[model samples]
Target: MRTALDVHISEVGPRDGLQSVKATMPTADKCRWIDALAAAGLREIEVGSFVPAKLLPQMADVAAVVRHALTLTVSHPGLRVMALVPNRRGAWAALTAGVHKLTLPVSASEAHSLANVRKTSAQMVEELRSVVALRNEVAPGVPVEVGLSTAFGCTLQGAVAEDDVIRLALACVEAGVDEVGLSDTTGMAHPAQVRRLFTRLRAELGSHAGAAHMHNTRGLGLANCLAAFDAGVRSFDSSLGGLGGCPYAPGASGNVVTEDLVFMFEAMGVSTGIDLQQLFAAREPLKAGLPGEPVYGMTPEAGLPRGWRA
Candidate 1:
């Protein structure tokens, strides 16, 4: 991965990682975690999702969290402050909250889409149209990213066809999303499959296709990420302490672990630019914030494999 791959790792721990656990962290604790990560050299972080509290109790403080993170993001214009929105309403709220990037999930598996968002794949595409329209109307330059979850496979639908993933990815781009992210929501992806699908999507959608959101469920999380990097994906999403796993999503953990990922890239000389020590420090606040929740990651627990750079 060091030779030619120069991927940018975006930590999703605060947003995706925390939302999976059963406990909730105070908004101030969330801000402190974000700052710790940023000071550690992380260029981007997804602060939280703007979903209804009734749906996900973990993300109930998303609005306030985003507001707090906004203050810090101003100091580093290169740093991205992003949030996840489930629908048009969430997107609108995120835009008003002053987030730099907004991502929406669109499942390629129709059955999974209905189960997750209560809408068919087609209906979700239509909803994205309105999201894009709203972004253009209010924040014209703001980036709108569609994280197409379950792009590889779904627990509900069993297997998601490659053709379906490609089709929905193209549709998301056509629907006006700035970038379409491929996610292994259930962690059923293989390196070869990731290489193939990413290649096809890149050839078709060009610049609109990017990012890889993988899970550690199958233990191929980092391997799949390297495969995506090999296939030309620059943006990779991960979470600190691997905090999140959808309650309704069976066997699906949150995105990849941030500590392990940064260790993999920076150790391999790929230049993630994130300090492992500071990243580990960020997790302390997360642990304190969400007490009683089990956080995941091996590198943090192992201490960066003996004699590593700070």
Candidate 2:
């Protein structure tokens, strides 16, 4: 995936974006949105999470959505259908659905971990090990990625130490996850902190270092992403229209906008293998699914610069 594109943009709007909003997008509309995204040249998309319907009604039809997205692989051969799995049970469900990849969110902050998953960081690592065992048995080839949320800092527990983030990442790597990525769960990360953590993560974890998932809450999302790229990150996680936040995370809102991020890279002459105009077009279904919902982005709203070519 990285070889063809200068940077890998893993669109997480379907899974991360819809889960935060109050409105539960209809299943058919979700498929239509995913179809639009794939047609826009997004090679990897997190279709949905496998959590219980009672917990997140927005994702109740995740299995069906994944099935629909899989059909697109026939036309977009490089498209990778992915899902977020909170635990072993969710992982089993995602594996059974034949998803191409799995992402597990593990918080570095103990307070956030307990509230989000009802488990401490250590307990979550153990949980990940169990999930890895299941994946090895049922789907050995499938990659399991862990997103270390709150790696920057936490609203509940202020000042998450840099050592704690690295320690947790190493623990997850030891637990058998294919990759470990840092997330600004509360959007508290600055460029310097982002650069430091990712630099250390790559030095220690090497090839296991993964995508940079930054939030735009403090308006530092793009800057932090640039810092991560400077620190040697090639893969990134973004939401179309800046649609994301953690319901469990109070005061946290907004993910890095896909349109703006692509524009930033393409303008710098770095290829993302995505069409800028087509990406803006994908937002139509998103708005159609959730009428009156406010979507955020500078590039799409401003339109491409005059005489611009991508």
Considering summed lDDT, which 10 consecutive residues are worst modelled in model 2? 1-10
Instruction: Please identify model 2 stretches exceeding 4 Å from their true place.
Output: none
> Which segments of candidate 1 are over 4 A away from where they belong?
1-5, 305-307
Tens digits of lDDT, candidate 2, 1-310: 7786889999999999999999999998899999999999999999999999999999999999999999999999979999999999999999999999999999999999999999999999999999999999999999999999999999999999999999999999999999999999999999999999999999999999999999999999999999999999999999999999998889999899999999999999889999999999999999999998899999998999899975
Model 2 scores a C-alpha lDDT of 0.96
Q: Best candidate, lDDT-wise?
A: 2
lDDT of 1: 0.84
Clash counts for the predictions, in order? 4, 0
Error of 2 at 129 (Å): 0.6
Each model's lDDT: 0.84, 0.96
lDDT of residue 183 for candidate 1 = 88
**lDDT of candidate 1 over 176-269, digit per residue (tens):** 9999989888988989999998888888889898789998888899999999888888889888887666655688876688888888888778
